[model samples]
Target: MTRASLVVVNYNTASDLRACLASAREKLGDAEVVVVDNGSTDGSVEMVREEFPWAPVFFFGKKGKV
Candidate 1:
């Protein structure tokens, strides 16, 4: 079950990102999903990590990077 890589960037959009992730999971379950959280204060990173633990999440700081 090998599929292409999927990269999604999120910025304080928790609910919408979840929906997109759900759709991607359904359509491309075999693919690897990577979610890059750009300095979120609404707990987007936590939500993604807890709910979609299978996916790898990269979190950037307030400057959107280290």
Candidate 2:
């Protein structure tokens, strides 16, 4: 278990999420980054998983085909 966690809720904002995660990583080094994707077709979940593999993502709502 992590001592702290950062929870991010994303919709179709993949680019923004990525930027936010990058900034978050720079700030919170040891904190856990948790992402909750709300059925984004813009491949938000996939981008996060691929780009920021350290962050654990919790998928919700409709899953994206992309």
Candidate 3:
């Protein structure tokens, strides 16, 4: 199987991120998921970390660019 990477940039949008992850999980199997939090104050990083522990989470500083 081919390996894939899913990169999701979150910015105070928790619901959308959850939905996106759910859909990704259903469609892509055995793929790596990466969630990049863009200094979101709505607990987006924590939510993703708790829900998708398998995925690697990255938190950028204020106005930080990737």
Candidate 4:
């Protein structure tokens, strides 16, 4: 079977990310989701972890610097 991957970069925008993830889940369905969090201080990472637990998360310290 073929596999798909989705990479989402999050930067303190939890609402946007949530909406995006919802759409992605609806569309992709079986694809793997990868979330790269750029040191979000607004608890975006935590929300992603709780809401989208099936998706893989990668943490990168600080945004614009990486």
Candidate 5:
């Protein structure tokens, strides 16, 4: 079976991202969760690193580079 990835693009929304990831973790079974951070200064990247270590994070450390 081919697995699907849930790509979530984020900025400075740490709280929101946390909630989203939490829900995904509880519900998404075998579906890879990928986070593409767009240079967030509000600790979004750090939060993901600490909380969702299983999810891969691709951080583009320059805002607006979507």
Candidate 6:
């Protein structure tokens, strides 16, 4: 069987990220969702870690998409 994955590359867009993830959870059932945070200082990392613990989050520590 084939597996689906969703990678969300974000930078200082915590609010939007929440909405996107929520929608993905509702629409994309059983899909693996990952978040790549580009060193956001707006508490995005914490929010993801706390709210979306199921999703794996990676910190790039830079201002570019990886």
Output the number of the TM-score-best candidate.
Answer: 6
RMSD of model 2 against the true structure = 3.8
TM-score: model 5 vs. ground truth:
0.89
Q: What overall lDDT goes with each candidate model? A: 0.89, 0.88, 0.86, 0.88, 0.91, 0.91
TM-score for predicted model 1 compared with the true structure = 0.89
Best by lDDT: 5
RMSD for all candidates, in order, please.
1.5, 3.8, 1.5, 1.4, 1.4, 1.6
- Native-referenced Cα lDDT, model 6: 0.91
Model 1 ranges off by over 4 Å: 64-66
Backbone clashes for every candidate come to 0, 0, 0, 0, 0, 0
Runs of candidate 3 with Cα error greater than 4 angstroms are none
- Model 4 agreement with the true structure over 1-66: per-residue lDDT tens digits: 438988999898999999999999999998888999988988888988899998877888867766
Candidate 6 local lDDT, 1-66, one digit each (tens): 328899999999999999999998899887999999999999998999999898889998878756
**By the lDDT metric, which is better: model 1 or model 2?**
1
Task: Give the TM-scores of the predictions, in the order they appear.
Answer: 0.89, 0.85, 0.87, 0.87, 0.89, 0.90
The stretch of ten residues in a row with the least summed lDDT in candidate 4 is 57-66
Worst 10 residues of 5 by lDDT: 1-10
**In model 4, what is the error at residue 46, expressed in angstroms?**
0.4
TM-score of 4: 0.87
Off by over 4 Å in 5: none
Selected candidate, larger lDDT, 2 vs 3: 2
